[model samples]
Target chain A: MKEIRWHGRGGQGGFTAARLLGMAASLSPGYYVQAFPSFGPERRGAPVLGFTRIDTKPIHDHSKVYSCDYVVVLDESLLAVVDVFEGLKADGIMLINSARGGEAFTASGRQVYTIDATGIALAVLGQPVTSTPMFGAFVGATGLVDLPAALTAVDMTLPADSRAKNREVVEWAYNELRRKINA
Target chain B: MSNEAWEGRRAFISANDAVSYAVRLCRPEVIAAYPITPQTSVVEKLSEFIAGGGMDCQFINVESEHSAMAAVMGAAMMGCRTFTASSSQGLMYMCEMLHYVSGSRFPVVMMNANRTLAAPWNIYGDHRDSLAMRDAGWLQVYVENAQEALDTVLQAYRVAEDAAVRTPAMVCLDGFVLTHTYEIVNIPGQREVDAFLPPYAPGENVLDLANPRSLCISVAPEWQTEFRCQQQAAMEAAKGAIARADGDFAAAFGRRWGGMVEEYRCEDADYVLLGMGSVMGTTRLVVDKLRAEGLKAGLMKIRFFRPFPREEIAALGRRVKGIGVIDRDVSFGNAGALYTEAKAALYSAGGASPHTVNFIAGLSGRDITKEHIETMYRKVMNAAAGGAEREIQFAGLRWEEW
Candidate 1:
């Protein structure tokens, strides 16, 4: 079983990204996926958390993700305000959507990887909805799901007109992360 | 109910959306609802379905939850399959009509998004609202996930409209936990649902103009007792009806939640954790973790709050060395409601009393963590080893002065 937590402010599509990942993972045979938000009375721009869990067996745990294998931060600004790496496992990875290069933070031996997901989103989608691009980075960093599977998930989740651009951003972010990893 | 093979389409949706889809499949003739937090999405989706021509039903936009229940009651009395949904404050507002609906024997199927009651005014998931109405004479069933929420709604109508047990039913899912969580759910086909639950036939309770008879009228003291006794008898008969509905639904749709209570690895365990609603999912995970550590821990999910599953619970209490009852709601001055009821049931059955503890957790949407459940199991194990100090412990309370 693999659990991933997404940290983003409200209206930044954190829940949408988690749901897309779940929907994409569910397409694979023998995979059980769950996506949910830590719901509270949070208005726009307030910090929020969304969670996704994928497993070979049927997922039964409904509790919040206290210790997750990966953490995806949609906004790097939240790093100063929120403890985005609170419950990340020692061997887990943190994928942050930032334009900065070589910005690093490690907690309890956890690794932090920064990517220009917002830049990719603005270039591809003409906006800063970093969820899709960050999803691409997640796929690239974790390799838990395939690029085609993630694109198919975007196709199913987003509207028709938005799918093409979202797919472009996803591919761009994925290739960018792969290039960075190799470098 | 036919045993014919029927296939269902699988989709990823939230529990609230699942309820809307199930109501559409059931094809309720009248749907009267008032929007409330965590429950608004259900009627919103249903209204969308109605607007998109996906379902042909009367959608009544009532002013309040009380009016919503009254509208459904009126429609049900006029021989229409009626449905509605509500949450904490709304349900409490509709409390009077809930009793009236059950007493009039109008098998109205309602979905309640379980939320915490107010003094501090919380809009989070808890069982206080629905459990407060346990004596209102409605068949209440708490579901653990989106699939169970969908499947239970289909079975609720079957159980509610049973000729022998003409009573109302409340299908409850935790407000945000299950209602907002997205899951992959297999929705049964309309043909299968129709086969399983034929159109509700309002027998002897309808408002017939051809044969005029007073309904819900004032009864003398002597006849009032009989009326109450008959309602009690019908409630008792509903136990069998609920079991039959589950069995028939399983044969038709390939999913069954063991009638009133679902036991998970409880047969050979020295300690059992009992709970209801979505928290049972967490309890199961805790049980598995404990079992991995060689502790004989198990979980029992009480699906049906009404009818209380006395026999099953009593038998479980006798078998397990100790039982921990996790209640999201309190009974005030005694213990959690489930803990109190389980103790009463065990005592009445005159059996060996297993050391029982009540763990009140998740009040007002407080997240019950894995650590809290681990502590609960450790305490249960301690009690089983004859080291119990308290009868009730609040799982996540912050003691400022202690």
Candidate 2:
């Protein structure tokens, strides 16, 4: 089983990204997925968590994710208040959405890939909804799911008017992060 | 019963929305509800489906949960199938109508998102809301996943509306745990669900102008006992109706929710953990881990709490050395409702009454983890093997009042 915990403020669509990942994984008959948000009363700017678990068999454990394979940060400013790496496994990766161009490092031979999904979102969608770009970056950097499947999930989730640009940003993030990972 | 070639499609959705889709397939005539947290999305989705031309049902906008129940009951009495949903405070607000709906044998089905009653003002999930209404004479079924939540609504209507059992049914989903969680579910085709569940035949119970009947009328003291006895007989009859509904539903749809009580690998096990709702899912996974480690651990999922499944509980009590009852709600001064019921079921049985323990866990939406379940199973196994026993063990506590 692969578990990913998403961190963001309430209006940032972190749970939407988590749900999209699950939807993408569920496109294949071999995978079972669970996507859920921390069910706290959502206030506009309050910090919240969302989770996605993907496995070959049905996922049954319903408790909050204490240990996770990946920690995806939707807002880089949240790092100052929240421990983004708290429950991350030793070999797990931390993917962040930052436009400040943070240094990418291999820590203790584990991958810590950083992508400027905010920059990609602003460049492509003209809004800072970084969920789709980060979704694409996670897929591209880790190869967790196929790009086509992830793009299909985006198409299925977003409306027709918004689909084209979101798809473009996802592709841009996927390519940009793939280049960085290969480099 | 349209049986032309049909197939169920798979979709990823929340239990809340899943109920809406199931309602569309069942084609309930009326839906009246007041939104509450964790449960708000269900009616929200249903409204969307209605406005989007997906369903052609009468949507009653009500002022309060009390009126919501009253509206559905009135519609149901007029021979139209109906649905309403509430949770926690909202459920408690409709307390007066809960009895009126069931006592009249309206067969009105409601999906309750099980949540905690307020103390310090919490909106999280727990079973206190629905379990508090246990004696209100409604059939209750707790679902473990989104698929079951959807499928059980279809089955709950079938069983509740059956001629032998004219009872209202509450299909419960754990508030945030099951309700808000998104899962991939196989949505039975509309024609298929229609085939499994025929249209609501109001029969003699409904209010018809041709043969008018009085309902919700006060009975005299001498006649009330017979009314209570008839309610008990109807509940007893519900046991068979529930099983047949599930079995017949399995023949139509591909899934069977194990009639009343679903046993997970309990035949050869020495000890068993029994619970309802979403915690049982975690227990099932933990049971797998225990079995892998050569521990003879198993789980019994009590699906319907109203019918009680006394026969199955007694038969299992005769075989297992111990049975642990996991309850998400406590009856204040007494044990959790499920533990008390399990003990009562075992006390009168003729065969061996296994040693028992009550685990009062997951109160006010506290996370019931894999470790908590494993520890409970170990306690059950240990107690059965002549170890120390605690009558009511509250799992995952930082410190205990006792």
Candidate 3:
């Protein structure tokens, strides 16, 4: 089973991103999936959590994800507020929406995929929220889910007028992952 | 009924844990409850299940009981079986939605760990919590033990979600007495529980976005009275539903007890002690002691307090010589609330109202011993024999002699 925890603000579309991922996972053969928000009376800017569980076997345990194989952070501010890296598996990957300024990292060498999803979202989608594009980056980092499939999931969640920008951010994240993997 | 076995089961869990297991068996599509003492553990357990992938339900840890009830109400309105748990003050906090859940006539099962209301601040077992919300149009049943707590919660879903009478019900067990007390509860196997309670269908929920309808909306006084009358009818209807559900539960689980009131040695009795919550267990022990001595005294466990179970209570009043209502909760100035309700139920019943004496004991967890029960019974017998005037009295209270 693969468990992914998404960290973002309440209105940053973390819940939508999780569900879309589950929908995409559900469409895939040999996969059973679940996606849901951690219930809290969080306001728009409050940090929130959404969870996704995908497994070949029928999942039986439904406790919070104590250990996650992948952690997607839509808002960089979450890292300061929450112990975002607390339970990341040794072989797990971290996807962040803050890779724009070419910042180098000396953090542990598991796998880190960063995309300036916020910049892409703001310029293209006209909002700085990075959940949808972060979903693309999440798919890009692990190749666990198909990039095209993840983008389609993102498109379904976004309104039509803003679909083009979301798709662009997703495409850019996918390319960034391809380049990082090749390097 | 006692020896029926479900193996790989016996979990020495708290009343809250038993409640959580029952809720899981109920298969609520949406489970929402806020964290409050005694009640919090159940929600925490379910949250663990939903989080760990054990239960496939939307477990919501809402900000308050109000939102918790709101979330469940919304889900239940959309045809999903819903659940929540709360205690004394928490139940009071969500009083508004309590009416909404039942008024909407949605099948939402709530487990209330009866506790004393705060001001002086007490968190122990008492009926003041559930008793306060008694008239909010919900079917209320009290359980004395952990196993009953578990079974009744599952049955509550069956009774509440049933198409015939789709009103919300509170399966109340005493706080700490059951909520915190650890006991061997036979958690029913999934298949057997499934057979007893089929998956809840959203047939009654009128919410179809395509064809929208508002529920629990304001109505003219005339229309409102009609709705309340319907609510009253449904509560009384629950007396039958409780009987049927208990029978079906017995047939399916081999655990059966007669309807709303569980009678213990009430037959041919001259004196009966009426009680609810865990104190009933104590009362039963007292009744047995009295019965062993050849005293024609028995105990009546008042499980359903809301629809008042007027007929059953009236019949008990007619049969018994003297009736003592041992209330673990009070209606404040009026003394024993349950006792008061029972007296009202008996007023219309013919005979000289069974010397109904109210014993307000076990408030905020004061232990009611066998001696206390015997004393209370003697008082009732004296009252019945001499036509004593004391209607409300305290059974066990500390006093200093001058």
Candidate 4:
């Protein structure tokens, strides 16, 4: 069971990102998918959470994701307030939305992928839904889930009026991820 | 129960290993836990299981015990089977989260190694820790031995995961007793366990984004009562599940320890002792010795502490003329901890006919013995025969030789 924990503030589309991921994974045959939010009374701008479980076998647990194989931080500011890498497996990959790219952190011990998801989100969606571009970065860093399926998930989850912009964001992020990973 | 599989496999594994093997058999999709001994070893083994590959699972190591359970809560909210473990201060620390895990109707399996809460700084066995949190809505079971520990841990998942009882379960094994003891346990292969416990498919969860249901979300009092009624119903439903799980476990493992109350030579006994955890092993010998001497003494081992198994306990009370409860742990300011629960369980039945006596001993590994058990039996029988007058009795006190 591959559990993905999405780190983002309440309104930063953490739950939305998780839903998109689940929707994307569900498109494939032999895949069991789930998405959930941390049920709390905390409001917007407060650190909020969403989680996903993707596995070939049926998923039986609906708990928060701890030692995620992949960690995707949508907001750079969260790093100071949250220990995003707390339970990550030593060999796990992390994708962060920072303009400094992967160079911000020393990658000698672990793989760290940096994508300017904020820039991509603002340019395409004209809003700060950093999760869309960050999701692209996550796909780029780890080949565990499919990019096409993820974009398809985005299409399903986004409102029809905002669908074109979200799709463009996904495409742009995927291409950038591919280029960086290949280089 | 068998040596065929473990004949040459006497490896030095921690309580965590036993927990992991049991969890692996239960086949939970999401495994979440935070570090707190003797609970850390459990999560560590799970991490190893995930790292070694083969068991397709999502292993989540969260920042704290709070998040550890929160993670499982979120997963269980999505209608997935989830699990985590904690002990003593850690269990207490997760108090608020514990209420949420069960209140939400999420069947999560958690193991709490009963340990003492701090004061003068002790890290050993005691019941006060878990006892304090008894009001929290989780089905609790206390195991007597390592084998029982392994068995009960697995059963917890089955019981908690049942649709009729979709509630979280906490299986308590005495720290340093069952938690550290090494025994030849018949660890069931995955296939048999799968046959016994089917995959969890909840009726609904937080994952259905399109259908989007609000869970553990705020609600008005009327709706809250309906939810509480459902929770209560599930807890009441667990009694049958416990018995059924015990019987099925015995049938599968070739070891029979059925019934809500495991009676030991209680058929025609005049005096009986009752309690949970490993102390019952020593208590058994005392009952046997008294029975051999024609004293009509026996034991009523209450395995499932929560749900209290009141009817079964009352039945045991009805058979016996007097009863003695040997508690290995105590709750300060209160009477012998387990003793209080036992009396409450047997109170209305026969108006406490068994004349229950409470004996507190062996807190923090003070070493309880067959002799101690003998002293308890004698005291309880004396009380039954009008040799003592105290309604509640204390056995084996050295009195500081003052």
Candidate 5:
């Protein structure tokens, strides 16, 4: 099973991105996926968690993810408030949506990758929400789902008026991270 | 996951949304339900469907949960297929009407998102909401996932509207855990659901002017005993109706939840852990893990609580050496309600071979982690091997005192 935890504030569309990941992964025949939020005291700016579990077999565990394969932070500001690395596996990768360099957040024993998801979101979606852009970066960082599947998920999840822009955001982050990782 | 797509109607949706799709397919003439957290999404989705003209049903915007049940009961009284839903405090608000619907022999089906009751003021998943209504004269069915939640809604209509069992049924989904959680669900075609459920044949149980019948009348002590006996008989008859509905549903939909209780890997098992709803899903994984480690572990999932599966429990007791009952709701002063009922069912099991331990956890939506389930299995293993173990143990407790 591949578990990814999304860290973002309330109203950031964190859960939407989590669900899109599940939808993208489950597009194939062999994959089974589940996405759920840590729902509590939900407000505009309170810290929240959205989790996605993708696996070849059906997921039977209903509990919160304690060990994650990847942790995607939609808001870099959440780094100071929440311990995003609490349940991160030793070899797990941490994908952050920040302008800071990856080395700034990278601990000695951790793999930390940074992407200007908000910058991409601002440029592409004309919005400050990093969920779509970070979603792309997640796929780029993990390669959990194919590029076409990720774009298809954006199209399936977004409204008709915004589908094109959101798809662009996903492709931008995905290709950017792919380019960086290859370099 | 099966390789076959069932014509590829698969979609990713929450269990609450799945219930909305199932309710739409059932073609209920009247849909009435008040909004409540977790459950509010189901109500919203249903309203969206009705607004979009996807369903030809009267959507009742009731003032309160009490009126929600009353509206459905009135519609059902007129021989109209009806549906309603509630959860937590909302379900408690409909307590009076719960008995009224069941006592009047109205086959009103409801979807309840199982949530923790408020005193500490929580809005999370727990079985306490449904277990508290154990004697409400309604048939309670708990589901494991979005697919079961959808399939059971159709089967609930079938079982409830059965001529033998004219009992109201409540299909429960664990709040937030199952309700808000999104998963890829195999949505069956509406034509298939319609074919399987057919239509709700009223069969003379209606308040019609031409029929000239008195309904919802009070029965005096002279005949109240017989009325109660008939209700009890209907409850007993529901056991078979539930099984038959599951069997027929399996034939039609290619999925079966083992009727009342699904025993997973029970054959040749020494220790079996029993639970209900989503917790059982987690427990099933733990059971498999234990089996892989050479421990004879099994999972007994209680699907139906109202028509308690005692015969199956007794049969399981006769086979296993130790049985662990994991209940998400406790009966307050006593042990977990599920554990208490399982023990009551195991009263006449000849010799005291299978030792019982109750693990009360996941109250108020606390995470019943894999480790917690494994701990329950370990305790069951210990008790089965004649090792000392507490009769009732709480899993994942912050402070382990008594």
Candidate 6:
């Protein structure tokens, strides 16, 4: 089982990102996935969290994700406001939507990958909804799901008018992050 | 029923959306509801369906939950299939009409998003809302996930509108837990649902001008007891109707929920954890983990809380050494409702009863984790070994040291 936790604000599309990730993973024949938000009464800019769990077998544990293999932060500002790495596994990976390099973050014995997802979102989507691009960086950081599958999920979730640019941004993030990791 | 082919489709959607889709397939003639948290999406999606010409139904926008129930009752009495949904405060507001709907034997199917009642003002998932009105003479079923939420609504109408069991039914899903969670679900086609659940024939309860019959008239004290007795008999008849509906649904669609209670990994287990709603999903995982560790642990998920499944509880209790009842709602001064009911069921079985413990957890939407479930199972095992300390235990209460 691979569990991932997402951190963002109320209007930042954290919930959408989690659902999209689950939908993408579930495209595989044998994968079982779940996506849910930590629901609360909140307005825009308030801290929000969402979770996704993917597995080879049917997933039964419905409780909140305490220990997760991946943590995706949609807003780098949430790093100081909340404990983004609270329950991350020892060998887990953290993907941040930031312009800063991975060396800026100190996560002992864990890999940290930083990408300028907001920039890509602004360039491609004409708005700063970083969920799609962040998902792209996720696919790039961990080759857990196919890039084509992730793009297909993006197409399914977004409007027809926005699909072309959203797909372009996702593909750009995936290739850009993969190049950075290899470098 | 139309001879349309069964063309079920799969979708990744929330439980709320699933309920909306199910209700659409059932094709209720009338839908009246006031929006409430968690439950708001069910009606919201239904409204979208109506607006988009996906559903042909009268969607009544009522002023309050009370009015919502009253409107549905009127529509249902006129021999039209009626539907509504509410949660927490909205349910409490509609409490008065609930009894009238049941007493008149109007088969109004309602989707209740089970939420905690408020004093400190919380909007999280709990069974307090629906369970509080358990004695309103309505058939109640709690679902674990989105697919069940969809399938059960289809089954609920069948059980509710059965001539032998003319009663209202509340299909419950945990407010935020199941209502907001997204998962893959197989939605059966309208043709299959229509074939399984034929149109609602208001048979004897129709309020027509041609008949001019008096309903719910003033009854003398002597006959009131008989009226109540007949209602009780109808409820008793519902047990069979529910089972048959589940069987027929399984034959039509490819899924069945074991009718009243779902026993998981309990064939050779000595200790079983029992609960209802979404929490049971977590308990099942813990049971599997304990089984892997060689502990004789299992789970019994109560589906129909109104029927109580007394016979199934007693039968399982006879084999297990101990059973833990994990309830998300408290009965205040008494034990949790499920724990008390299970104990009474075992006591009436005319034999030695299993050692039972009550673990009250997840009130006001607090998270009940795997650790809490594991602790409850361990307590049951210890009690089975005669290490029992108390009858009722609060699973995740925080206390300051004295």
Best model number under DockQ: 2
Tens-digit lDDT track of model 5 for A38-149: 8756788889899999999988888888999899999989988999898899999999998987899866368998999989989977789889999999999888999899
Question: What is candidate 1's local distance difference test score?
Answer: 0.88
Please give the C-alpha DockQ score of model 1.
0.75
Model 5 chain A weakest lDDT span, ten residues long: A101-110
Q: What RMSD does model 4 have?
A: 19.2
Against the true structure, candidate 6 reaches a TM-score of 0.97
Looking at model 1, the pairs that clash are none
Could you give candidate 3's fraction of true interface contacts?
0.00
Give one digit per residue, the lDDT tens place, for model 3 in A111-163.
66777888778877788878777877777777777876777666555678877
Give the Å shift of residue B188 in candidate 1: 1.3
Candidate 5, DockQ score (0 to 1): 0.83
* lDDT of each candidate versus the true structure: 0.88, 0.88, 0.77, 0.74, 0.89, 0.89
What docking class should model 6 receive? medium
Give per-residue CA lDDT, model 2, range B8-65, as digits (tens). 6688888898887887788988999999998999998888778867777989989999
For all predicted structures, in order, the TM-scores are 0.96, 0.97, 0.67, 0.65, 0.97, 0.97
Which scores higher on DockQ, 2 or 3?
Answer: 2
Off by over 4 Å in 2: A100-109, B1-7, B400-402
Cα lDDT for residue B243, candidate 4: 80
Candidate 3, residues B1-402, lDDT tens digits: the string is: 021332337544556888888887777888888877667789888888788677789987688899989999888778787889888888999999998888878878888888788878967767888888977888889987777889888788888877768889898877655675444466888778888899887673668888888876888887988988888778777778888999999988888756688888888899998888677766776777788999998888888886677888889877777899888877767778888888888997886577778888888766676677788888888998986547787755568210
Per-residue CA lDDT of candidate 5, range B1-402, in tens?
A: 221333237888899988987888789999898999879989888888788767789999999999999999999999989998899999999999999999999999999999999888899989999999999999999999998999999999999999999999999999999999998888888778878988888888898897799777798999999998999999899999999999999999899988898989999999998899998888888888898999999998999998998888888888889999989898878999999999988876665558899998999999998988898888888888889998988887789833
Clashes by residue pair, model 6? none
Q: In model 2, how large is the Cα lDDT of residue B243?
A: 85
Please report the TM-score between candidate 3 and the true structure: 0.67
